[model samples]
Target: MGDKLTTKTYWESYYSHNHADKKHIKTVCGYYNDFWKTFIDSKNESSTIIEIGGFPGRYLAYLSSKFKLLPTCLDYNSDTSQIEASFRIMNVETYSVLQKDFTKYKTPQTYNYVLSNGFVEHFEDYNHILDLHVDYLAPKGRMLIMIPNMRGYIRFYKYLVDYQNLKIHNLKCMKLKVFKDFAQRHDLKVIHLGYFGGFPLGVHQKSNLFQKLIYKGHRLVFKYVANRLLLKKPSRFFSSSIITILEKQ
Candidate 1:
């Protein structure tokens, strides 16, 4: 909590410089796709949704595309007007609230789906962060938390390109067991939880012949061998993220 990584100022700079208008990524792994449909109908246009720590609101845009539902973006750095303007261009109906600290934000409102992507792993008091998500969730609502696979083998690539960000994340929060235990501690129901999103070889690192061969070889195995045999199940060694879908109990 004392570290610069845990500070709101750090994240404000991060969003301002990097993802100010980052495009919403559409192509997700098959497992996530199935889980999406299993948890929510594609035609869903009425369920209330919220994305915490979503600044510049890219995931909000993505969710609008995925579920055809309007989602609220709750972030300290968010500009409701800017986000809504962008969504308007994209024909998405959305709203945003700018709040510096989610833990202290007062709200009687709860959402049907509460979500955060790459959010919890930055804090040492990650459990407390998770508690807030649970608190904002409506009864029977599901909260989806996704943390990057920086603790796994992919960390090497992340370190090579973005070591500052690598240090920004608390690696301890990336473990699958942490979320599983957290759900149990809170008496929440684990809808679906595990390491997900197939191998991430798309990290564009400067490669020599050796690295190129290694990456290409793994990409081949990931697409043809691993995905086929494992049914595209994500493993810690190759997965890009650890995702948990937990229902408030």
Candidate 2:
């Protein structure tokens, strides 16, 4: 990984140029919102949440729609006008957006939940990054971390389909034991650890017709056959992402 400043510049430029489209945001927000709602349903409506690396605030907007929350979004990207506009479009009020690096940012108050998705893997010093997230959690608060599971079947499919630009992912893999060790080091209890989402056949988007057909066929199998057969056992080998829920001790 690059130096802190170099990493910051990369993300700033990335976000500045690659804002998610409304449709994509809606889809991702819906997926993540389901997980949040399921985990937090019993909590008070006034629960506070801080989403580190929440660039477009789509997840924040979704949570706001379901519950009265105190949301704070932190990201290195300085220009968040588009994200603010998205919040307005979603009718989400009472949220704060901060332009700061999570590894160094300090908060006066800890939160009920600290959330991150596709964030920690960017850094070489992921242990430090994990510690930073835990520092912002109140006692017994939950930290939700989601990252691409490179060991999963999606990687194998990409290789088989000869997916273009496979080298783009900064981090190689997020192993299950890595997360368990991180939680143990911080004295945080691992409440939930599992893989979700189906195979990522979408990575072959730029490939040939045969590759595209394979992608679609695999998607259907996951949707119809694999899902029914494997609903009780979401394999780390096949799932696209790994989700880890930890509670502060």
Question: What stretches of model 1 exceed 4 Å from their correct place?
Answer: 1-13, 16-32, 41-44, 65-68, 78-82, 201-231
Among all windows of 10 consecutive residues in model 1, the one with the lowest summed lDDT is 22-31
Whose lDDT is greatest here?
2
Candidates' C-alpha lDDT: 0.70, 0.73
Q: Give per-model CA RMSD.
A: 4.0, 3.4
- The regions of model 2 sitting more than 4 angstroms off are 1-27, 32-34, 41-43, 160-166, 170-173, 208-217, 227-232
For residue 80, model 2's alpha carbon misses the true position, in angstroms, by 0.9
For model 2, residues 1-249, the per-residue Cα lDDT tens digits are 243423566655556653435666677777665567655644588788888898877776666556777788888787788668667766677788888867667878899888898887766677777778877899988888988766656667777674442444534447888888888888988888878776555562366788878778897898777865554566778777788888888
Q: Which ten residues in a row are the worst by lDDT in model 2?
A: 164-173
Q: What's model 2's lDDT at 76?
A: 73
The top-ranked prediction according to TM-score is 2
Candidate 1 lDDT, tens digit per residue, 14-84? 45533324343343222366666656556647788888887666666666656876577787753355555
